[model samples]
Target chain A: MTNETASAYPGVSALVHKHLPKVPFTADKTLTDANITVEPAHFLELMQGLKERRELAFDYLRNVVGIDMQDEGLVCKYQLHSMKHRHSIQVTVHTPPGNPHIPSLTGLYAAADWHEREAAEMLGLVFDGHPNLKNLLLDEDVRIHPLLKAHPLQKMEIAQGIEDRDPGFKF
Target chain B: MTVWPEERLVTADAFNTVDMTINVGPQHPATHGVFRMVLTVDGEMVVDCEPYIGYLHRGLEKLTENHDYRQSMGWWDRTDYLAGMACEMAYCMAVEKLGQFEVPERAEYIRVMMVELSRILSHLMFFGAFGADVGSFGTSFIYAWRERERIYDFFEEVSGDRMFPTYFRPGGVQMDLPENYEDRVRWLLGSIRQGLEDFDGLLTGNEIFVERCRGLSPVSQEQAVDWGLGGACLRSTGLAYDIRKVEPYSVYDRLKFDIPVGKTGDVFDRFIVRMAEAWQSTKIIEQCLDQMPKGLVLNPDLPKTLRIDSGECYIRTEGTKGEYGVYAMAKGGNKPYRMKLRSPSFCNLSALKQMVVGHYVADAIIILGSLDIVLGEVDK
Candidate 1:
């Protein structure tokens, strides 16, 4: 691990290093909270270790956000808090340009169910093993990922037209 | 051959019934604000539940990403419309954290006062609406509105609009409190306390309301934390883990108040916790009034157009409902690269399926109401 990453949250970094020394983890600096960036390959194992470790019991999955980096790839961020320790950390997972797949945390945290679905529907990040990864906060039939940077913000009339459905009878 | 009325004896298998699906609200009043849930029932007991949202999703995050930092304040307030100021505070705090803006000391106290008042406003709404769900109907709603209107009047006097004030800026509030506001708020508190007493007599003191909610859907502290429940719902389970107390934000550290926890995390516990929390909010406001210093409300060093080189922060505040968190990332621009609201109502509502699965159909509605979910936040 880099010095900057270790310095962000020294206690958590020390704990992560002691438990999962083999995992290739790097630190990302943020204005607030300890953030660590990891690849999709090591995502699940690292998360499991974080939760199972007695001293670093990050049991509560606070928030999940998916960001689209046009050139790099899609990013999935998970904010976790240990109710026991009251310390929080942000986990960042990046998938290559076309592959937006990451392991789901639904098994470990029940809170991941809706959050993963929301992330999936919003930015099209696929969470493998999420039981019902259907469209959330969107129509069941709608397949578009509105949050992707490629998707333009259109006017209401133009957006309605793009859907290619019937504009019901006018009065 | 047809059996006579008393001749045939009824066996357990004789009355076999098929499971039925009942759809409640994209419009129903009990579901509360454009939320819909499909419940599969074995007679009266709900076997399964699937909630449908997004009818009100206006792409809040998308809108925030598109607009300037200050321009998006209007949309954030609408998330928890019942407590608009509380949502604004979270949004502003996130912006301030990312930009490293210093808010005037007076503004912090004012922001805390308004947010606490907003919390009371939200809890009163829950009290009224939950009372209606428990069969009190219009009486409780009217009683809640009596205090709510008085509070709204104060809000309107401070800011032009009542519901979505959009009064908080990144560095501070849009403007200072109105002159003579302290006297008005003191009078309002007296009226609000009386309103709480009336609700106590009408709902809490009533045996029917007590018995109906007492043992319903009890949640353990571990279960609450595992399910990511927050606010009164999590506290009802005896966790005593309030964001305000555990992680003090704004002026909460200076204030003196008690976090009311419940013995059993049931519907009744959720109700009582919120009631006690509302009472505590009044105390915090009174403290703000006593300790508030005279100074500028907005930061003097703020630029006309705020810009940050690059920074990211997840700021969490004790929203009226729960932990209202904002994960903000700014990358060399007036607008943030990404802003995500970890709305309390959304997280609290996510565990509805587990909470409502084994309860009666009527009781499921009560469970949903007890969660005190504002759909605007959930769908956003």
Candidate 2:
């Protein structure tokens, strides 16, 4: 971990790699300076550790999002920031096609509870160990996560085509 | 603070009290939107609570995947309906970051003024709702919205729409501040000050209002820090962390205002912090107007459609509630590979479980009100 090459961008990404090892952590050229990507397993450890540390405390759990990676399935991302350092980092864990599960970070950051639940219901990622995991943004009667690529909209019969529905029927 | 030892004091058979689960929204005005809360209660004490959202979720995330970046501006308005401008700012910042575009100085100043105005507006709604929660009745609620109407007038003049002001874009604002904007804003600011002073006498000093909120729903400094509460919610806990000062996005660093703090981490403190913040926001707008640069609003060099080629960026700012952040990933395309919003209400609402666990059932609504959540932001 310590033997890896140092990050060239010594601003936000510097603090990021400084705390985590070089196993799956890698940087991609993005808008601001750099976009640091880490493995899901390593991400959980890095974030949990970041929450505990005093000097490098990434105390604020800023945002959680679920993104469809097309062929790669869904990638659940967490954007974490530090109130003290004025820096930010993006951590992502990929869920496999169809069924997906990741260890919940609600234990570490309580904010992750609803986010994980939303992601679970929206993109179909099972957040194991979430104290009260349930469908947040969708009804049980309405099946399928609309955000998922594999979920067939036509088959679900939720959103009818413009041609299929008669508006004037008023039923 | 009594720290109970880690032990199960009540067994399943010993529990004679069963919590009555009450579903409180998807229709109730207090739920704030098409959202519902499942409150499990024994008499007036709440045993458990769960928030149900997505009644208004129109699959905007999926819709964005089909539309261009410019079209996505409309969705930001729907996310945080009250603080639409802040959402627009965050979205614009993310797009600007992704495209490596810059907004003109005049645009930046106008943007700052607009966001500050929106911040005041959101806080007004918070104060009104919080007052309503505690039976303060139409007095604070009416006064807050009445003052908010002036700001909406300014919004209507600037952008054709009053509520959903989709007045921001990647390169800059949708357009410059309207003609005679300085006069209107100045008048609005003066009106807000007078309204605030009247509000002070009518609601702030009222004995009943103060007593209901002073110590109820108290949050310790460590608890606030641990829970990741921000904006006025965090300030009520005695921490003076304002992203405008700390991170200093846009032209905020150029301006000056004190980030108000409270000594006591209670509902009263939260109210006090927000009231002071409305004044601070007014001060910010005054400064922006005084020294607002005269130039183009949008960056002339940027192209029509944002083509963010192979990059990702997370741009954030202190919205009315807290840290409103946007994460954008572009893979050499016009449309974003993925766009994610890290909403403030979502983070603020996270503290509800801890805050209400030990308090009475009535305090649950007060705590939720103190958190100042917008369901659109929460569900997003």
Cα error, residue B273 of model 1, in Å, equals: 0.3
* Candidate-wise lDDT, in order: 0.89, 0.77
Q: Write the per-residue lDDT of candidate 2 for residues B1-380, one digit (tens) a residue.
A: 98777585777787687668888887987766676778888878887877666777666666665568999899988888998998999888877776767778888888889998999899888878888888887888998989988889889888998989899987788787767889888988999999889878877998988887888878877777667787888888888788787667889878989999998789889888989999999999999999997889988898777677776766778989988877777787778777777778877877777777767877777777888888888776
Q: Tens digit of lDDT per residue, candidate 1, span B1-380?
A: 97678747787889889999999999999998999999999999999999898899999998998888999999999999999999999889988887888988999999999999999999999999999999999999999999999999989988999999988898888888888998888988999999999999999999999999999999998889889999999999998888887777887888999999998999999999999999999999999999999989999799989898888888888998999989898888899898999988999999999999999999999999999999999988
Q: Report how far off residue B374 is in candidate 1 (Å).
A: 0.5
Error of 2 at B74 (Å): 1.4
Most lDDT-accurate candidate: 1
Q: Which ten residues in a row have the lowest lDDT in candidate 1 chain B?
A: B2-11
CA shift of B332, model 2, Å: 3.1
DockQ for all models: 0.44, 0.33
Model 2 docking grade: acceptable
